[model samples]
Each structure stands twice: as C-alpha cells, then as structure tokens.
Target: MKIMVLSSYAPTLFLFREDMMNAMLENGHQVIAAAPEPEEEWESKFKKRNIKYVSIKGIERTGANPIKDIKGFFSILKAIKREKPDKIIAYQAKTIAYGCIAAKILNVNEIYALMGGLGSIIRNKNKKSLARNILKAEYKIAFKSCNKVFFQNKDDCNEAVGTGLIKNEKIVMINGSGVNLEKFTKKQIPAKPVFLFIGRILKDKGVIEYIKAAETVKERYPEARIQILGSFDTNPTAIKEEYIYKYVNEGLIEYLGSTNDVRPYLEKCQVFVLPSYHEGTSKSMLEAMATGRPIITTDAPGCREPVINEGNGFLVPVSNVEKLAEKMIWMIEHQDKVEEMGRESLKICREKYDVKKVNDVILKTMDLKKVRKNQNVI
Candidate 1:
C-alpha cells in the first residue's frame, strides 16, 4: 500500500511517528511524507533514510486565512493527484483539513486524521470572536470529512463529540504518539536539581508560569537550575519575542534554542515540567517519562494524561503560576522522592506507551492485514 503522511511540521512527524513510519516501511508499504519544506537539516535526515518527501504550503494553526486555506487545499490536491496514494494519514489541524479535502477529491480509499492536539484555537474556552468562529467552522469541515479521526487523549475525543466536531464513533484514542524508549533511555538523576520545560517556547505552553515557578524556586534554592528549550513559534499563542528576551535577560531561565536531540538535557534533569494549556499527549512529556524524569505538567487534557500525580509527578491547574510553583518546590524539597517517581514514570511509559505496541494497534485499525492479503491475492 502507498501511504501519504501529511503534517505542517515534518520534524514533529519524524520525532513522534518515526516508529510507525519504520513499521509501515518494514511491512513493505511505500511511505511518502508530504509536509512543509523542512529545514535543510531535517531534509538531510529524511534523505538519509531514503524516504520520499514532498513540500506543501499549509498554515500551522487555526486562523482566518481563507486565501491560504484555498491555496493549501489545491496544493494538497495536486500532490494527491500526483501520488495517487491508496491511503492518506494526516496529522494536526491544517494538514488534516486540507488532506481530507484532497483525499475526497482524489477518491482515496482510506484516510485517517491524527488529532494530535486540539490546540488553543479549538480548545480555548473564551470564544466570542470572529477568529474563534472561523476556527470552529474549519473543525466542522476537516473532522466531518475524515474517514476516521484518531485522538491522543480522552478529553479531546469527548470535546470533539460534545462540540459536534466529530461523531464519538468516528474517534479512536491512541497513546500520545508512543515514545521511543531506546532513543530516550533511563538516566541517573543529577545531583543539582534541574527542572526542564521542553516544548515550543509559546506562551500557551505555560512559559510564563514556568518562568514564575523558576523564579520562586530559585529564590529559596539559589543553585536550582531551570532550562527552557524549543523554538519561538509563530503561532498566535507563542511567547512574544520581547517577553522571552526579558525573561532570559532577567536570568529566570537558561534558554537553549531548539535542538534535534533532547536526551542530553533529559538525562541532566531531575524533574521535567510542562505547564501547557493543553496537548494531544505531549511527546516530550512521554520522552521525559521514558528518560525516567519525574514530571510537573498541567491538569488539562493531553497534558494531564502522562503524569499520574504524585506517582510519577505532580499536576497543576492550567496557567496557575502559584500552583505550578508549589509543585516544582515540592519536588525540590523532597529531592529523594525524585528517583522513586522517576522509576514509576519509567514503569508507566514502558508499560503503556511502547511505540511498537501502539503502532500495531494503529495498523490493525487501518486493516493492514486485510489490505496486504488482498494485494497478495491480486
């Protein structure tokens, strides 16, 4: 079977869905990645794997950009025509919407939209605005058109149904794109307490809360280190450049620009924190768990699933700086518990988020066996 995978961020796909891709390729299916033109570094990595790749223009998030939407739809339509893939797998909102539209036009047999995360546009409670309405409409079109919608967390699945975005029966919940235990192996806890927040340096990711928590913790434990990785995104919720600079200059966080490898940092940290507003199931959180680092994340949707609260880590309410700070401080004060929680984290991740197991379930749902049998018969 020829499978065309579409996403705005190709590196994200490589990071989260690499196992699935390798499994599909190993099973003798042709895999073609259709996404934004990746950076040279990412493109080089893809080329090294000898995977076929194509570039498409698509918005990263929900916005009132019909002009771009129409253009992206047609761009994807052309790719569909050229590839004539037997199946299409779309990830994230924009790519999923455009991919579904193109698949419907090209009459593709199987289509799957991976709702990795709902993002702030769709999930934001305060929605009395034109942009919100436009985003809602986009959801209706994109989700309704897909053959199946794969969600990462129960909250997203329930919300999609409650909002009539997609039927409950149409949704399948999978572990946040399963983590690669091999790539992110267990590590020894560092002596000095280091808390890491690894995600897009967006305001919605609770960057402000992280900074506040870092400051509070630092005041008491002066030697405690906090690091924020991931790039500044152009998303509406992204942290403003000025605010980022201010925080950095004030010595609140040691900012390490985005890097291909995060394991080194993961290994160096005693605890990982992600105060995200929401998530589809944060790959980074799972990576942190796999690396045996206790977590501190929000109690919202995708963000809440990974941490078992005082078992593997603590959970704070979304955007609650005081609560986030308290949780971080708890981990700092009870440093001995860090290793125990890290052990629990590793246990949970290895048990529930084994990449191969999740990918197998996905393949079964897509009827890979039946498809393969039919092809062989032909």
Candidate 2:
C-alpha cells in the first residue's frame, strides 16, 4: 500500500505521524509526507529515514485566497495521480478540506480525515463570520467524502454529527495522537513540586490562565516551580512574546523556550498542566501520562479526556485562573500524592493509549486488514 499523509505544519507530521509512517514502512507499505517546507534539520531527519516529502506552501490557515486554494486542490490531485496512493490521511483544517476534494477526483481507495481540533472556526462564538460559514460548508463536504473521520475527543465527534457533517458510523475516536511510551517513560518525580506547561503559546491554549494560576500558587507555595516550554505561534490567538518575557522576568514562570524533545523536562516535573480552552486530544497530556507525570488541565472537551480527577490529577474550569490556582495549590500542599498520581497516569496511558494500540485501530479503521486479507500477498 502507498499512503500519503498531509498537513500544513512541518512540526505536526514530524512530531506526531513520523513514527506511524515508520511503522507502516516496517510493514512493507510505501509512505510519503506532504507538508510545508520544513527547516533544514527537519529535512535532514526525513532524508535519513528515506521518507519522501513534497513541499506545499501557502496552504496554511488564514491563507485562504481562493485562487491559491483552487491551485492547491489541483496540485494535490496531480500528486495523487502521479503517486497513485491507496490511501490518503490528512490533518489540520485546510489540508483535510482540500485533501478530501483531491481524493474524490483521484478515486483514492481510502481517505482518513483527522479533526485535531474544531479550532477557532467552530469554537469561536461568532458563527456569522463569512470565513467560519465557508469553513463549515467545506467541512460538511469533506466529512461526507471521507472513508473515516478521526476525532480526538467526543465533543468534536458529537459536534460534527450534530452539524450533519458526518454520519455516526463514519466517526472513529482515538486518543489524541498516541504518545511514544518508550521515548517518554517514567521518571523520578521532583523533590519539590513542579508544574510544567508544554504547547504552543496561544491565547486559546490558556497561557494567560496558566500565568495567573502560577502567580496565585506562588503566593501560597513560594517554593513551587512553574515552567513553560513552547514556541510562540503565528495563530491569531497567540500570546505576545513581550508578555511571555515579562512573566519569565517576574519569576511568575520559567520560560525554558522550545525544544525538540520534552522528555528531559518532563522528568523533572511532578505535574503537567494545560488549561487550554479545548483540544482534539492533547498530545502533550498523553505524553505527560506516558512519562508518569500527574496532569492538571481544564474541564473542557479535548483537554479533559486524559484526566480522571483524584486519580491522575485534577481539572479546573477553563479560563478560571483562581480555580486553576487552587488546584495547583492543592497539588503542592499534598506532595505525597504526586508519585501515586504519576503511577496512575502511566497506567492509564499504557492501558488506553499505547501508540501501537491506537495506531492499530487507525489501520483497522482504514480497512487495511481486509485489503491485505483479500490480496493474500503476504
């Protein structure tokens, strides 16, 4: 089988789907990735793995010129015809919408659309915006054309169903892209309570709330550590760099900056926190669980899935800095439960979200088993 996975961002595929592509390759299927041109380091890594890549720029969010969008659609269709892939899996908003259109023309046997998040298009309160309305229509068409629509959370699945974007049978739920357990294994919980946040610094990701909560926690547990590691995003909702710098300078939180590997920092943390407004299934939360770090996230959709309050960690109201702070304070006051919660976090990941297990479900949903069984080529 030949499979092409497409996304708008380089980091997303490099970080999340690279292992899955390698797994498919090990199983004797050809794999290729289509993404925006990545940095030299990412390009080098792909070359080392012998993964083919096609650079498709200007296909990002807010780059919605109809002319470029039309060109992108046909360009992808041409690529599909040339590669003749048996399946195409797409992530991110624009890629999924266009990939579905191209797959229809190419008559691809299987198309998997990953709704990583409903994103601002649907999550934003303003439903009357022209862009949002257009996006909604595009999603309806994309979902109708997809062989399987993968959702990270129940809310996204339910929303799509309610909007008549997809039939109940077409939706498949998976843990937010599974974490690499071996890569993010258990570590010794820090001697002093440490709370870490890892994700792009976007307003919708609740960076402001996390900052306020950190300040509140410090008032009670002055020795408590709060660290944030992630790059600023170009998304409209991104936090200003100056604000992040101010927080770092004020000792509200230690900004460790972004890194390719987060495991080293996760090892030194007792709690992983993400007070994001929502998520498809937060990959960072999954990694925190795999690394045996207790989690404290919001009670909203995608963010709440990995947490079982009092078992792994706690959940507070989204955007409520005071409540988030109280939860952090509780974690600090009862430091003895850190490791116990960490143990439970790891247990949950191992049982419910092992990468192999989640990837297997994706393969089965694509009907790869039936395809191979009928071919009987092995």
> Which candidate comes out best when scored by TM-score?
2
What is candidate 2's local distance difference test score? 0.83
1-378, model 2: which lDDT tens digit per residue?
888888877777887887777667666666678776644545566756667676665576547589887777776777778778889999898889888878887789888898898997677668678777888888888888898899988998888888777899988898878888888898888888889999999998999999998988998888899999999888878888999999888988899999988889888888999999988889889998998899999999998888999899998988999989998988888889988999999999998888888888887787555232221111
Off by over 4 Å in 2: 38-43, 369-378
- Candidate 2 global TM-score: 0.94
Candidate 2, 290: how far from true, in Å?
Answer: 1.1
Task: Give each prediction's root-mean-square deviation over alpha carbons.
Answer: 2.9, 2.9
Residue pairs in candidate 1 whose N, alpha carbon or C atoms collide under 3 angstroms: 203-239
**Candidate 2 pairs with clashing backbones:** none
